[model samples]
Target: MKELDEANKKYNSDFVEKVKKTDVGENLKRIKIKKNVYIDSLIQPGFIYYIETGVVLRSFVDAAGNIKAIDILCAQEVMGLRSLIGRVGVQLEIKALEEVTILIIPEKLILANLQDAYHFLCSNFQYTMSIMYLHWQAMLSFGSERINYALIALAYYVGTEKDGEFFFPPYITHDVIASFASVTRSYVSRHVSKLADDDILVNQAKKMKIKDMDTLIKNTPNYQSF
Candidate 1:
């Protein structure tokens, strides 16, 4: 996870530098978003955003009123690309998990620059493939292992590391994990408690910390492939 974070940071830095060298980059607008705020204003057509800092939850509510978490984006992520490609019809609910800073770029600007457009598409493709891979892995698993894998996946994307331990933010409650795992909140709680008891992880104050990565991987079937 640490290596992945560093890689993303480097990529984002390089991408920003490349964009800044172009004329379109001069017109980029930066904005700050408060935690728990919905970005309705940025949902307008012909714009995309680069996440300069913090995390955001991308989700959708079904007709049954079930909220499904589609993505948990952090620093270096690009948002609104799916809409530009005409791949999404149902409106996605995007809310900040923490204070966020983003650089807004016009859609036309990106389209006019072949290199920028290609990089944007490549980043989106990598992200989509990762999500698809996790979905496929989850479908092949069952019971508590699925929940564990969900935690692992979440940690990979948004968990912060300090002194060799990984911690998920307080905003990521059991309900959020349940939504990500496509499981009931109670089921998620039970698995989480078990992991806590085993000293593999601990959940308190609405935050989760992973203590034993090896044990966690062992409990999660086929997690090494992830």
Candidate 2:
């Protein structure tokens, strides 16, 4: 376990070093965010963030007065690119799921300094498209199957493989899952229990594990090809 932890640390360090070598990364300002703190208002126009460590929960209050989790981002991911590109006012509320370190870079600087914007643009586009697809899938799953769709979407966002087993981060709770599913907490709990009973998922001490990846992908609607 200690070896695994060390390997993960080294991997993250190597990734950060690679990012730091980029033109936009060279001039970035690092900011540390405490857990549960709101960061949306801190993001001004023409600025974007790059996650260096920890998790960030992107959520927003809907028209029905309910806060919804739009996405969960971790290290090596970019945030606020959509808002910057659209030149729109900030609408998303970003919260730190844990102690987070991010590098803030001005959009103007990136555009001016980066020789090849294609890679950055492609990365942002792909992430945005995935989130958009998740929203679309959730909308399609509205009535009775929403929970399943939400679980698949959440897995796509934060699930990682360790020793060939897929698991979600320990920080992800029923409430967070509820927000992602846009369902009630009770509903999430019930569905999660059902998944456990069905042997699709296992709620363990520190994480929720997907028992069979092939079975899960096959059973989840609109996720078979994903």
Candidate 3:
């Protein structure tokens, strides 16, 4: 999370301001998406989306037609890099987990307007690598430990923080967490109850919070090894 946070801080926040003064920017489509809405069934070519607020889940369908959650991305993240090369479909799907605002810019426009394109691309690469690293960590874990790591990641990526505690919205149900952890919903519920009993977490009515991060991390085997 530290590395990911640092990369986020390096993103050029001024990109929008610079774009606003240009003619192409005037035609930029910034759309508001409601919670639980699907952004697209298949990847769209020739455009990239800049998340302005809220979170989304990125998933892909396998040959078996089963959808699996691959990543959860939040504000300031840019998606659809493959679209720049005209890559379309591939069974990718994007769905809004929260009310989201996204700025859809043509690929050429992002390249033309983005100052420090190298750093921007690097930052995006860092974010992608971070998620892959987390997936690798989860692969080495098992049972509740896997769930623990998933919760920690979800907290960092999608939860809101206040006074050193992380609060996850009500829509982040056991099923949602189970998908990320590659576990069953019942398994997630059982482990979450154990965490609550230990006072490391608080989950009520589908909403959750990390009440004690140190204790929660202690339960996640090898979580700090990275």
Candidate 4:
């Protein structure tokens, strides 16, 4: 993991530089989506996703009848990478946790650009696997009773800030979060209050500023051992 992080820094930098260039000579063009919304809820349900800015979550319900968030996508992360390739439409509804600008490219256009479409398909398969792994880590992080679901959501939504504060917008209501964490709204509300009372969170008009991100991450109990 340590070596991967070091290698990732170089790849990420190069990726950013490549993305900045205006001339890529592909059939792809940019489309801006300014609204803060669930991506699956907004689009016509058949567009490819390449995020230019902001974040989104690709999630669905489990067979055990639990709604779970499977992915937290950020800038440079591809959207509908898994659901729209071989599939007709998205089986999992993607929710936008933040105001976003997604570059929607047509699936046909992307396919046309691929000389080796099978290779492209394989790479997308790996990307989907990566998202699944991240979600598995998040699930393990949340299954602990020692940690509140709100903290789980925050950690999943915004892991840690540069200033070591995990600032989160209060747009996430308890009711909406209920389905994701597989907890009742009342349970989520109770934890929200506890964090606020502990001064771990400051409830702003539209957001909750979480202080002490390091302590939150550290003190957050692990469930894997149990």
List the candidates' TM-scores in order. 0.85, 0.80, 0.86, 0.62
Clashes of 2: 0
Poorly placed runs, candidate 4 (over 4 Å): 1-26, 34-38, 41-47, 61-67, 88-90, 97-99, 106-131, 137-153, 156-163, 170-179, 223-226
lDDT of each: 0.77, 0.71, 0.76, 0.55
lDDT leader:
1
Q: Which pairs clash in the backbone of model 1?
A: none
lDDT of 2 by residue, 1-226 (tens): 2232234335434434554566543676889999999998887767767788899999888899887888787776667767677775438888999899988877656666354444556545655675677588777766336777766666655777776567888778888888888888888878778878988889867578877666666766665334
C-alpha lDDT (0 to 100) for residue 118 of candidate 4: 51
**65-138: candidate 3 lDDT, tens digit per residue:** 55567887777777777666565656567888889998876666667766655666667777777778888888
Report the error of model 3 at residue 213, Å: 1.7
Instruction: Write the residue-wise lDDT of candidate 1 on 1-226 in tens digits.
Output: 4454455556656766666667533788899999999985576566778889988888888888888788788788778776767766878889998999998877766766667568657756765776777777876888788788888877766777787678987878888888877778999999899889888998887768998877788888767553
- Residues 1-226 of candidate 4 have per-residue lDDT tens digits of 2232234334433433333353255545666555456557544434556676777766677778666655556665566554464554436767666677766566565455454445444555655555445445556655324235445544544554547666654545555556556666677678767778877766566566667655555655552210
Distance from true location, Cα of 49 in model 1, Å: 0.9
Considering lDDT, which of the candidate structures 1 and 4 is the better prediction for this target? 1
Sequence-dependent TM-score of model 4: 0.62
